[model samples]
Target chain A: MISPVKVWRNQKKIQKILGLYGIIVSWTKVHVPPVGFSSQAPYVIVVVKLESGKSYIAQLVDWSENSLKTGQKVKAVLRRTKNPGEEGVIPYGVKFKPV
Target chain B: MKISVLGAATTKFGELWSRSPRDLVMEAVNEALDDSKEISLQDIEAVYVGNMLSGTLGGQDHLGAFFAEELGLHVPAMKVEGACASGGLAIHAGVTAVSSGIYENVLVVGIEKMTDFKPEEVAEALMGAGSDPERDAGASFPSLYALMARVHMEKYGTTEEDMAAVAVKNHYHASLNSHAQFTFPVTMEKVMESPVVSSPLKLLDCSPISDGAAAVILSSKIKKTGRNIFIVGSAVATDSLGLAERDDLTTIYAAKEAARKAYKMSGVGPNEIDVAEVHDCFTIAEIIAMEDLGFFGKGEAARAVRLGQTRLGGRPVINTSGGLKACGHPVGATGVKQVVEIYRQLKGIAGKKQVKGAKLGLTHNVGGSGATAVVNILKG
Candidate 1:
């Protein structure tokens, strides 16, 4: 399924939270849990803005200081969780990668 | 109908370790009673207890009856919860109960014990404050406010320094409060250099997990002997629990509405408030609060705070008791604690941190992000 940000951008009002290349509105390296249900441990999270201007929070791939910066250009990608459920069911969904 | 706060008291805020939730409540209650022996224990007809995580955090529920039984008072007792606003909402209920003539003497207590749990466990417990399938996306609590901080910066040129300034100001205020959990001062450099809990939000920006309780005894029958602190206006409001659901991230509309109703009821405008106790659960909260409560423009709170406008002798002397940030937020106890500070200041007794000769004060409490807001105007 598309990320909530994408779904929201699909709405008429926020059709552009995504720009030609989505922009990073905010980014953080969270060491705490209960933040993302599927997140295993410390990982980089970013609220990426779509070309339509709708903002969505998802994990950042190719994570590095050089890889991510505020207002940096990025695009959406689907990635799998580092940790799987007890049943070994791996969840896959939206993530962001540098352009 | 009219209500008077005969007395107010609070336990020193911090990790009590040995103090059970019941112990803390009884301590605050007894102090409040001792402050006004004029009102007999038998005269208190009802009790309203505000607690956010007693059931989950302490494995205790039915706190109202529990507290009453512990005190050996048979009056009807009940619990009130509104996330962080639990304490303030309890005050509202207790005041209304007395004002409605349903009870002559009432006890309103707000308590929270949150230090026993581990960090992850605490995060899990706090998650209960937000809505599921929405804000509870496993995002860390600070991340929510961090997002707001970034947006406020992007949208209005608010800076990282602006947010850290709040921590600096509150830490300084806390140093003067004997009961504050964190009484040591922190510099802006320290706040900014602190490890990042979330982007743009550091460890210093958050209110610590604290254990403490605050209590106030309200009575219409008590003789007006000493300083009479009256509750002239009380109001509460709610908004969507999920932060993302809000159309705008910069403002907490519930606080605005509650303050509006409170100001209208008290016939006191924001400018007329000599002092205020605001919910500064996070540094960003205080900024948005100043804006929502009409103390500053939409994007001007940070700049105003930087100019020392919210400091002692500045603007309205916001958070003279160090606020939840430095004073320690014991969840359900915060609302009562804020009132306690107002009571002292209005009575011209806040010592060094006192806003001198303050006759009117406002206490603004918010639950979760902005899900619940309570504004009460008090007069000397």
Candidate 2:
């Protein structure tokens, strides 16, 4: 489980990147995920070149095969990063979706 | 450059359920001491232990002191960690100590016990080497390498079959290795048909989680005998922890930089390296390493590997000990085991897997995606 304090501190950072536009530089579909991410197995993760000239790595949500290619336009969205288990903070983070 | 590896030894690499960390260390260290007839445990002036997941999985840290006590030593000891490059870093430390004239003899051991935890737990702990954003995206180690594989495929027309050949070749080499995790050669078809851990990277492309220990004795006091192996180069380089931050996904700049430094220090170009044990955590990783290490030109490694240019009979034969793919990757133990493999080869004692007239050898170890790399050159 993620620390509540840490999650809280990361919220502001997440807010800054929210709704940002980007282009996919590279992508991969994670068939096997680590702990806390089993619920999202087989998720697409992408390296996105953001409009602000920064690069980010995040899950590509609401994606289809057509949207999973290099240079695909995407926008960052707020979403639950992982299952926090029982009595843990529901951590939200930035995920990219086909723009 | 004056430091020599007086002795090197490794425990079997695999899911050794019966062995504890203490058991593995004692076996490897004692065997290493035995290998160097001129040295004993009492002669070790310092101890450097390399480990990655002991505290995360086993909830035990302070491995340097822990192993020192286990070996009945009261010398100065400390643990070294650089994700998977922990072992290589520890060896670098030992070389620095001896070359600096701070100590004449030192013990460096790399060990990891991963079978004790669930696969997911082990996967999660391994991500400690990666960036927080990568972990937040639920990226496992395979996924990280898979990303690179996808880009390589698109840019160079590298095929899944090319990657599969890497597994087939490494498994073939592993078949000749008694201590390998997988002692049977795998067919290319078998590797291509294996279940995908991540797209473009099948189960066969990834190294198995293993339990093992490797120990090496470094000494400047050792007499220069006919069979003595000397460390000609020891260098490390670091880069961005996350793949997204890298300027190019097709290369690991840290590895390139480390290899560059190692070559310059040893005054031995890639052509002179008769044998090499490179980090093959993933098939794509080996391909990229080949290019980064200057053994092959950019976008040429996949084809070269598929053509058997890196096989046992090939020039500068790579991963003769099965590499991490078939030899088993015990994280921390891999870097040290690479050194042990080269030491054996240089000493002309690496039976069956020995490279003929191996005068010079190199070992490459990487941590995280491309965040850290350690390169070492040895001369027989």
> Which prediction has the highest DockQ against the true structure?
2
Off by over 4 Å in 2: B224-226
lDDT of 1 by residue, B14-33 (tens): 98899988899889988988
Q: What is candidate 2's lDDT per residue for B212-300, written digit by digit as tens?
A: 99999999976544478989999999999898988889999999999999999889899889999999999999999999999999999
Residue B145 CA displacement from its true place in model 1, Å: 0.9
Give the Cα error of residue B68 in candidate 2, in Å. Answer: 0.4
TM-score of 2: 0.99
* Candidate 2: pairs in clash: none
> What are the root-mean-square deviations of the candidates from the true structure over C-alphas?
4.6, 1.0
Candidate 2 C-alpha lDDT tens digits along A6-71:
888888889889999999988988888899988788899999999999999999999999998999
The 0-to-1 C-alpha lDDT of every candidate, in the order given, reads: 0.82, 0.93
Classified by CAPRI criteria, candidate 2 counts as high
Best by TM-score: 2
Candidate 2, residue B267: lDDT? 91
